[model samples]
Target: MSAGQVIKCKAAVAWEPGKPLVIEDVEVAPPKVHEVRIKIVATGVCHTDWECLYGTGKGMKFRPFPLVLGHEAAGVVESVGPEVTKFSPGDKVIPLFLPQCGECDRCQSPKTNLCKKNWANTQVGVLADGTSRISCKGQQVYQFLGVSSFSQYTVVPDTSLAKIKSDAPLDKVCLLGCGVSTGYGAAIKTAKVEKDSSCAVFGLGAVGLAAVMGCQAAGAKTIIGVDINPNKFAKARVFGTTECINPRDHPNKTIQEVLVEKTCGGVDYALECVGSPVIMTAALESTTDAWGTCVIAGWSETEAMNVVVEKILMGRTLKGTYFGGWKSVQDVPKLVDDYMKNKLKLDEFITHKLKLDQVNEAFDLLKSGESIRTVISLF
Candidate 1:
């Protein structure tokens, strides 16, 4: 394929909410100004993608259907749009749903990682130009997030990709695009977990395990894993959870109460990877009253929470992270380097691997909570 030429490829598109994705041949238009076209090799299926496809949260349901829904992916730059100077063909890259347009005020600030470029608009299913580049059966298929790695080829703004080392494995490092980055950064950057501090990560999925890894890497001495599923305990231990607690095991006391008692007060850090508002509240209450920190790493639902103001009044900190509080273009490549250096683990997060045609089966595994992450090999 050449510049300004349309490319034809296969894509897994979800035509309706709560439905399986269909393998369809799609037409990918050439990237416009400041956009880059990528040929995705491998993509990781995440809970957010499943939520978008299942249409559970209002967060992702707003994106129109007949959509390509995979955000955590690694690919090679196939072409660059006019006036795009940062990337070229053959550069190994990871598409970032959270873009970093250097021109924005937030991009210039050190206090925040959000770029006010085209985020709000992209969530509505269009790119910077208020249009989509993917089409199937002569109909427009909205892109999922900005990555849409479920497709063989996708076009995203140049600001929405991070260039990685050429020798890195796309199949493995693809995870750094979402879950790994989100969770690991949640503990390392957002929580700033200190050495000898105590941490409780609620949820044992790939993101939670990544958080566990982050806590361990940050030198936290007491890392506790909390989940209802005991089956995840073994896997969580491998990721550095010193103790695993099944909430159901303590029937009489609240999970937060159990955590407070176990820590002799409350944990120094509580990270919630579960999206439920109740769990969010519990995680906050599980923190040390004087100097406890709670970070909501999960994308929460629209439901209102009845938070006790006393939780914050006692010097407790409650906050949340967007993309793990890391600037996408700047930090993602460093994470890739970490993976390359063996300082991070991505292979363990992938529980299953399947072809593009098995995309529905991947979703089924996700629905059953039997897989941490299912990687789809687009080749």
Candidate 2:
């Protein structure tokens, strides 16, 4: 503890969801062991952030009031904890939405993207050791998803920080932390998309388009983008979507029919990026018979929607994917490199940018579906 350790900053606090975001000065503490202080350069306004604010009709869980909410972000390391080894002040870094220690058993396992050791710490919105690292006005506050980039500065474990090339644009590359990684990983890693395979992504938002890019990367010859909004087709095409189908155009028949004709009896893999049960149903129904894989990439309240089990009799499999079934430290840096090399379409994903004060405006645009992605530029 140092005599001049006191610090103050601004953040968007969710005292209550469905209410306006509370922007006010907040206090932050110094980094603890294995932790690093990050000056958030940019953070993406994701649907999951909104869900965390307004509990999904399915009863989404979150910590009590005064939580700094954000997950996908990129920035510069402002300070480092006593035991941090891989990073230091001035290092360019992206805060992973999910933290993973490279030495953990789950990090070694292929089936799970989650690192088991951090479970208890993440659940309580504190450090893995059950200590509060952030406080506001002397009252302890919870860090949303470990890296709460909604604030100007936040602390995260060294394992949660992915150092990237200093030359990479933090605003564009920030999406890779969560949305891009989650969607692309679901398609390539979880679904293990085969070359020339047929796939359909049911949502053309940031994550959905990332899925489209993932499909293209995986060598899927026929990639179908499904969304009710016709405007999304333009953006979907940029990500290598060969076919864009509007569910409204086929009003008489279900989306499954359109996908069947376009993909030849549905698709070999279906990625559900929209949280609605209707879209979930469409995702399952659009799977190919005998061996189709349907991956749920959206966040929704479990109690709000009923799982229709009858459609899965054809040997279709439905699974949930988090952080793209990836170990953050290993996968994120590679994705950043791909973005830098022009192998990935990150610019296509960012449609807007705002500062900390404009966060609510970003949310308004998000609610209107007017943008593919909105970034809050803290730098």
Candidate 3:
């Protein structure tokens, strides 16, 4: 494989909104300047990818049809375009949807991880050159989040890639690209969870479970997992949850009220990973009044969050995190290194694995809450 060459490979394409992905042979063009082509080995099925396939109320803001949907992935560098010097063929890497362009204002800031240059292109679903490298049956296909790892081969900007150690397993590190990092970073980075403090995670999905792991790693004495599904509690405990609460169990009381009562006032930290504005509000209100911090790590399509004026006035801090507040170029590789050292848990998050042809069934597993993370094995 070389630059400017067209490679035919199998990919899951979204022909229309609210429809199952079609597995077809798509043409992946060679990388252009400052871009690299990757042979994706594995990709995790994330909620963001699912929401993009099924149109959100925001109306195609993210659900661009005829797009190759997927972002959280790990693969090998197949080829590099002109002017590319950092990576070469055979290098293992992960595609970062939230790229780290060091020259951008956000990248330079220590407080944020978002890159301005790549963030702008994220909305258009195209490469930095304002064009796509995927096509099928003579029709152009848009790249989702620039990576589009649902395809066997894809082109990505050099800045949007994180080279990892060769020994790292692609099937496992792929989860760190998004959900795990987002949830873990929300606890250790955004909220700065403290030792002996209490924390609450308001979802049992992969991201929420990662948050639980983060709190435990931070030495939090009491970790509470809240979800409507009780089946998830066992899995949550595997990640270090001290207690589990099903909101449905307390039908007469709000989740916030139950949380407040259980923690004696409220938890020192609350994380909303479900992406519902309702849950976001509850997480905030459930935090201890005079210093508790709440982090919103979920994505909501159309929900508008409403917070009481006094909530912030009383000293509660509310923050939003993207990609776990991690600098992809710098931090993702370190996360992989952490996993290699057994300091982070990745294998436990994967509840099911399927081939690319079973991609639709992966989504069904996620929707039914039967799996923590469904990995699509491209190889």
Candidate 4:
């Protein structure tokens, strides 16, 4: 617990692709310059983590193995290195997988939330220093998404830390780190959904549900939830989905056809929460002609997202977002505050909670489409 001192702790390490994680003792090197060490209290299992583990996508197949893989996490700062002025010991914070270097052009521009400088290091699973902070039995373990909350303890750049209120429940607010924020922001920020407008959301996972909640918050009159699984409809309703449609029920008709017919042409806004190229195309096609806006919130690692050029030519806008278009360090704290005030629904998103030992089981729940968000308690 002092600066520059290594600490040994438990971490769920992914040894290889398509393999269960192993809870092993990991040596976490103390904060280097401008870095802060955190004791992870809770983390959420995200689909992106699962994709990183088993996805055969271009960059995903080549990801460095023996990596620690949880990103949506909330923790208390245990130590801070030299030149770290933003946070101190005992401060509650969420580690941002997307760090915000305010000096970057992307950070300075109002049009984007992506910080251009720190993002390159995330591709290689190294820190800003171009090295790993975790080691197991003298072998290096790469960090995942820069946050790497799978470990009981993690070290991140000071710029990556989003300090929140001390009393905020780490277990619930941890969802704000990714899913909740990404989904909710896709509606409120990216799409800027208008009041009483019709909206269609594809997929019913945590991110999709959050998108539903966001559309409701924006006062959308007709919020339609589209998913292949009927079981997800009940929970999707609780999150403000006014109508539910299962593609399985309409086998004769395409999902986009059903949605467009149901909405009397097409919806005002269409949000694609599923990372499928087919669904991405359908989402675009399901929107109202001339004015419909389609926001791609899901992260699709595969190469081409083919859509008819005529779709855009007809005045339908296709846009993509990262982290829901919210600047992480600047906006995540406010989201935590919104959750505390009951303006945001965090508890409803958490369908299961498990201990660190059940990390693989959490992934199973996600893969089986049985849980909305499974929070892993590291404490």
Candidate lDDT scores, in order, read: 0.90, 0.83, 0.92, 0.92
lDDT of 2 by residue, 210-270 (tens): 9999999999988989998898898899899998988888879889887877766889999
Model 2: runs farther than 4 Å from truth? 1-4, 56-59, 304-313
Residues 6-89, candidate 3: write the lDDT tens digits.
Answer: 999999999988889999999999999999999999999998888887745652354466899989999999999999999999
Deviation in angstroms for 11 in model 3?
Answer: 0.5
* lDDT tens per residue, model 4, 1-379: 3667899999999999889999999999998888899999999999999999988464244689889999999999999988999998999999998778788888898999988655778767888789879999899899998889999999998888899999999999999999999999999999999999999999999999999999999999999999988999999999999999988899899998998999899999999998888889999999989999999998776556779999899899999888999998999999999999999999999999999999999999999999999999997
List pairs with backbone clashes in candidate 3. none
Clashing pairs in 1: none
TM-score of 3: 0.98
lDDT score of model 4?
0.92
* Superposition error at 289 for model 4 (Å): 0.8
| Ranking, lDDT, top scorer first | 3, 4, 1, 2
